[model samples]
Target: GGIITQTPKFLIGQEGQKLTLKCQQNFNHDTMYWYRQDSGKGLRLIYYSITENDLQKGDLSEGYDASREKKSSFSLTVTSAQKNEMAVFLCASSMAKQDTQYFGPGTRLLVL
Candidate 1:
């Protein structure tokens, strides 16, 4: 078994600030994903990478950027933070898109 680690745990930002969140996994999975969760809502996929240096934009990728520096790491950036907003950003890994995904502890963000 392996675990996924999300850095900083908490993030505070000002309106319009660009914030970055990071994730790393020891599972050595071939695919990694970034998802955003709003209160009372399901996760929305932001970005995913199938392998090192391979990037794919998801439904909610318009205001975000992602990078897969290596198979074990993925990172996401909020292009512009919105005021008085809060959300949890989750990281996940899977052997294939159809396979079950293992999630990391989320990074919570609050914008003031």
Candidate 2:
């Protein structure tokens, strides 16, 4: 049994500002991922890390940066936030690339 936690449940940022969100997990999973969910929209992959110090950019990684500073933590930064770009950032983990993934509650971001 394990749990994942995301900090700053709500984030308010200015347009074009760089905002960061953090996630932590204790599941000892090998794969961690960051996804963005727009209002009423499906999940879009931002970035993923297979292991500590290993980074993989996903389909939607153009405006985001991700880090796997340690096995238990992953962080994401929005390079340049856009107006009306409110979305929820979700963190997920999987034992393997093709395994079922567990997701965090998500961090809501509102760009003003």
Candidate 3:
């Protein structure tokens, strides 16, 4: 069994601020992902990394940046925060892109 950890469980930011979220896993998986969830909507892919130092942009990647510093850690940055909004960011990992993914506890963000 493995576990995923997301840091700073809660994030509060101001409009236009650049905020960062982080994830780490012990599964030794090769594929890691970052997803954003808006109220009443399904999860949206924001970024993914197939291996260390390799990053792939997803549908919502236009306003974000990601990094895979090592096989077990991945991070994401929101280029510009929107005011009076909230969202949940989830981190997941799988053995391969098409394999079952295990998710981490999400990081909740609130922009004030």
Write down the lDDT of every candidate, Cα atoms only. 0.95, 0.94, 0.95
lDDT of 3 by residue, 1-112 (tens): 9999998799999999999899999999999999999988899999999999999989999889999999999999999998997999999999997899999999999999
Task: Name the better of 2 and 3 by TM-score.
Answer: 3
lDDT of 3 at 100: 98
RMSD of 3: 0.7
lDDT of 1 by residue, 32-104 (tens): 9999999788999999999999999999999899999999999999999999989999999998879889999
Q: Which candidate leads the pack in lDDT?
A: 3
The lDDT of model 3 is 0.95
**Collision count of model 1:** 0
Reference-based TM-score of each model: 0.96, 0.96, 0.97
| Each candidate: RMSD | 0.8, 0.9, 0.7
Candidate 2 lDDT over 1-112, as tens digits, reads 8999998899999999999999999999999999999867799999999999999999899989999999999999999999978889999999889999999999999999
Query: Pairing residues by index, what is the TM-score of model 1?
Result: 0.96
- Using lDDT, rank the candidates from best to worst: 3, 1, 2
